[model samples]
Target: MPPHIRIYDVTQNISSMLPVYPGDPGFSREVLKSLEWGDPYTLSALHLSAHAGTHIDAPSHFIRGGRSVHEIPIERLIMMVDLIDSGTVVSPENLSGLNPLAEGVIFRTGSLTGYLSEGAARACVDRRLKLIGTDALSVDSSEEDAVHRLLLSNDMLILEGLYLEGVPAGVHTLLCMPLKIEGAEASPVRAILAPAEWHQWIL
Candidate 1:
């Protein structure tokens, strides 16, 4: 028999109260009432950074004269995927292992939680990846910020702070939907992976 349908959630856990960026407030939730409190139902309130955990950074994140997250076209939120397991620094040659249809690329560097080296970025681009996503804080070298500029200048959409440990590398349907926060540079997203056939679209 064939394998049962599988859905891989590629997103991070939402913390009602957790650490956030420097000088930025993390998420906080307060329940006003509940059945246990003898009220009709439960109600809650929340506060969090627009660019907190597992977020998508819009062009405006760095470029002052760029489009905000809301201004971005919704079409960019969904695309065919390739979860490339580079295993460390993504080599230029690793790109060849990727399916060309994965215009939306989410790379995994095993346990990497920081930026990338210039060499890695160069290798990635040599393979013609358009959009870039990573399970780290950023996808480029932090010292010079060269890799960041290289990819962003080419109109790449950067998905930062993903948690992709067990996902397999292959053709999959990706649905990464960020919050619709107007004028915000970025927002957290709920990312997921599923079989292409389940989405009724070929990868």
Candidate 2:
């Protein structure tokens, strides 16, 4: 018999308390109707930045004529991933022995706020990765946005603000589904992970 598989949600909860980049808009919801108010139904209006909460950054985020969120191929979002415990600093040397066979890579940096060094971003580009996910709020530090530019300009997708608290580092299957927002540079995603043993069945 096949082994019982478990799925893990690696996405951040989308709420007003969720952290946002310095200048980015925060999440908010306005209730238009409430059952308690005798409106007969519950309705809400949500306002949030495209990159709010756990999100995916498309090429258009930094490239002038690059593909937008809706243009990303679905197959690329869901694939076998290599999870690495990259500590707090993600330098090129930190990624020196990356698996060439890995199509997707997720970095567990042990911080809700951190960034990937420029050289590390270049390393990822050189490796020709399809997608990169991180537990950090943003891939680039508050000082600069070079990492996002390098990765997105190369047509590589980025997933940020992941809640990877207890997830193990190793081979796993990533299931990231971003909103199909036309012409948008980024979109929030529901990121999930499952053991590598479930990869064959999922794909």
- Report model 1's TM-score to 2 decimal places: 0.81
Taken over the whole model, the C-alpha lDDT of each candidate is 0.72, 0.87
Model 1 lDDT per residue over 1-203, tens place: 98888888887787864434445677777888888889998988877777677888777777767777888777677777788777656556667677766767777876434556667666656656656788766676443557766666555678877878788778778778888888988889998888866445632
Q: Residue-wise lDDT of candidate 2 within 1-203, one digit each (tens)? A: 98677789998899999999888988999999999899989999999999998999999999999999999888888788888889887888767667666788888888867779899899888888988889988898877888998999899999999998888777888999999999999999999998775667766
Candidate 2 error regions (>4 Å) = none
Q: In angstroms, how far off is 172's CA in candidate 1? A: 1.4
Cα RMSD (Å) per model?
A: 3.0, 1.4
lDDT of model 2 at position 31: 99
**Highest TM-score scorer:** 2
Of candidate 1, the 10-residue stretch with the lowest lDDT total is: 16-25
Please state the error at residue 19 of candidate 1 in Å.
6.7
Candidate 1 positional error at 174, Å: 0.9
